[model samples]
Target: MSLLESWDRGEHTAETLRGTTATYATYRKGSGPGVVVIHEIPGLTPDVIAFGEEVVAAGFTVVMPHLFGRPEAGLSPLAVAGAMRQVCVSREFTKLATGETSPVAGWLRSLARELHTELGGPGVGALGMCFTGGFALAMMVDESVAAPVLCQPSVPFVPGRRRGADLNLSPADLGVVRERAAAGCQVLGLQYAGDPLTGTRFDTLAGEIGDAFLRVDLPGRRHSTVTTHRQQEAVDRVLAFFTERLS
Candidate 1:
């Protein structure tokens, strides 16, 4: 069996879930307070879905928003890689399909509200990874986001061959989110040992963000290992973090 299969069968239960597909294919599963999950560079693959389910098993509704609502819905990593290129290279394309005015982020906020209402009013928890790591923070800018877990968040230092360059939140937006954090919201981050992309930047962000930031470093773990390779530990840490912060 694959690694994801093992994690699912042992740690999490699978359930069919749905969310608004207005601009993108959003999906959700499990129960209790909601948890919004954003995908990595490869889009909404089985790995991402499994991660959502893991959170769901921890007693939170998990929502995985399909940012790339096109044909690249977790078929091949290569295809999603191409889509990543398009996101950076073709601004007009992204603007046309998703809009320049923070389309996906807006959609996420709407979904968070949906969870708040659907699950009876406790604001949703958001967990973003790799390409969508900063998405948790972006979701917070709107105020409905109470708890955010960024597992190896990517895209902040998007200059070169970074881990998650697809995340493109503006600095001004960051400032607004930081202001929210100062007002008492909590943002949690988890990363591995040697991921150059998430480690250095994660530290810098934790330092700059101050009390609102909760950083968890897996000493010998790598980038993907945080959630992919080290499945049980990651899920445990995620559940604890969300429970402590969200519950």
Candidate 2:
């Protein structure tokens, strides 16, 4: 049997997307406004796929890229740990930088642009979860990304006071983000009220983007507001946001 055969691809068609730095297999499904669902660490677990289907059913084309790990692996502790190790060493990810965005965001932007070009809408939406959560924010630098949703954005290894609030963006990039928000691109953020993994970045985002950063704080200390923890309210709000923005 093929190594990839064991993985359930569901209704998504396997394709390839290339950018300046990286190229990866993309599983695309649905037809309408495009939404790029970037998987978190541990790769595209079943949890993420289920959520992507949620978006697809809500009337948006969803493309999930297999960034690392087995495309369809169990969401075991070992799987998460293994993916975390890979992310820690991967050149595409910026795990501990205070003022820079991850390199993978570039490729994500390219994907969003390609989707927008194909669909011919105002723009496409980009939703990043957990480890890739802040990536949606970085993808906002591009004009092709109209709707950016960040779920429990944990990045720059926010342990200290400085990194805790870092936006995982360079000064210039942060400025561009601010400018984009000023020009009317609203950024949606979802997370728990007390998620330590998310640090103080929400406060930082509020301070940086002002009212343009729509904050949706769910109750509890859990991470993964949309996937692992699976908040219904958060999920509803996400679909609504896509409807209002992408639809």
Best by TM-score: 2
lDDT (10s digit) by residue, model 1, range 99-201: 1223356667777776777775447788887656766767887677788877776554433544233334456667776798888888887777667676365
TM for every model, in the order presented, reads 0.74, 0.91
lDDT of 2 by residue, 166-187 (tens): 8888888899999999999999
Q: For model 2, what is the error of residue 233's alpha carbon versus the real structure, in angstroms, after optimal superposition?
A: 0.3
Each candidate's number of clashing pairs is 0, 0
lDDT of 2: 0.85
Q: How many backbone clashes does candidate 1 have?
A: 0
Give the TM-score comparing model 1 with the true structure, all chains together. 0.74
